[model samples]
Target chain A: MEESKQEIRLPRLGEPAPDFEAPTTHGTIRLDDYKGSWLVLFSHPADFTPVCTTEFMAFAEIYEELQKRGVELLGISVDSITSHIAWVRNVEEKAGVKIPFPIIADLNKEVAGRFGMVHPGQSKTETVRCVFVIDPNQIVRAMIYYPLTTGRNMAEVLRLIDALQTIDQHGVATPANWKPGDMVIVPPPNTQEMAKERLKQRYECVDWYFCKKKL
Target chain B: MGCISPDGTPTESGKKMLLALQKGLRSPQDIAKETGLPLFRVRSGLRDIAVAGLAEQKDDSYELSPKGTELVASLL
Candidate 1:
């Protein structure tokens, strides 16, 4: 007798994001609605928690910067819509900063389960901090996971988005500590002749395999 | 390379340890227990924090240095 197996699909780099429609603070949002813009889909454990509160505030502060780069932010938690609304109101009133993004209320863990945010070893009922940087085409470009105790680096998140957009525009990779206006790595040459030619290229080359050029 | 190690960014465990340190969780064992991370990973994170000049060892416990405090403050 053959046993039936369930296929598990996790969103990965260079692959399409798992689409979903969910209720949010702003309204019910669908993944396809953000088709032409980059999306940062992030998950937190719960609202009203200290670490999660700080993260939400940080994300709110960077809302404009992300928008300027044509990127949108979507926050998700396994909390009800009522709780999300109240928390957003409380945060805005206390912090005096406007949260211009919609936060998804994944009360049933539907979105969380689909995104693999619920790590049993971490906490069965809470979602760990997970960030998925999806490109304009809905491809998962980069992913970062943080435990519940940690708050994410907003600067690093912005930098990653910039790097992803840069790579999309130019077929190149970023080097360590790469920021905007920094030298970017050139794609490695496939052929020996190309490698030899790469060394003679105008870009600064530490070696044939490692060449960097300014954007 | 950036000031952060292991790909110029703190690993997840390192981040967790740093947050715990910011909250006055000084002992590595305490951080491990609080953050639900393995003791070895917590120790590794503490070492990374020290190397980054974010924390200082005092006897068997650790505390955030001035620079580390400043860094955490800037995050908020």
Candidate 2:
């Protein structure tokens, strides 16, 4: 039976995010619609669950902040469109935070399976918590997954988006636990001569293999 | 670190431990016995699982967290 359905493959870093058209709570939307803007494509196990509810509320809180940076958010689950609408309404009424983004109704599991959101061992019917950060060019920049019991950290997600955008604009990588205004890591030197020269440069170097410079 | 690659993939022993967890084995000794891996290797793999948030340590045993179960399913 599983063989009858199309196989789903998760997109890797530096690869183009898979494009698809699906019915969402806001309306029908496509991956192409998000072109020229960064996107956060995330999936939860199911709608109305406690963990998912908290995550949605958190995502809603950051929606405007993300928009300010030219980023959009798209959420997905195996639930029906009606369920999504009801959940959004319920959440808004209870939490008073509007969900500005569209929630894709991936009833067929086409999108979920394609994104490897559905883990048979976990539930066989529900998606695990998954997040994909795609850049404006549609290239996937990062992927994060969490267990059902753990709600995602919204601050970390925003920080990652900022880090990715910074790297994109400056062509430099961020150091561990990087935040805005933090010194970013310089790309490692490719040749021994360059490595030797790098040490003499002004950047702070823990070693030739590691160096950080102010952006 | 030894059980997981830099890219976040589980090494061979890591995969074995995950498989054992999927089969409902929770104790480190049980996982080692089920996968025929050494006790130290099983423990190392369990640590990787915990680090990845795929499993949780409860008392003296380890159990597959939702993320770990999902990973094992995806592997299958």
Docking category for candidate 2?
incorrect
Error of 2 at A86 (Å): 0.8
lDDT of 2 by residue, B1-76 (tens): 5476669888777888888888664887789679875453466567667888978998758988998888899899
Off by over 4 Å in 1: A1-9, B1-76
> In angstroms, how far off is A58's CA in candidate 1?
0.5
Locate the minimum summed-lDDT window of 10 residues in model 1 chain A: A3-12
| Best candidate, lDDT | 2
CA lDDT of every candidate: 0.82, 0.84
Show the colliding residue pairs in model 2. Answer: none
Model 1 residue pairs with clashes: none
Candidate 1 matches the true fold with a TM-score of 0.71
| DockQ result, candidate 2 | 0.01
Error of 1 at A162 (Å): 0.6
Q: Kindly list the per-residue Cα lDDT of model 1 for residues A6-115, writing each as its tens digit.
A: 33346778888888878776545677667767899999999999899999999988988997898889999999988988898888899886776778899888888778
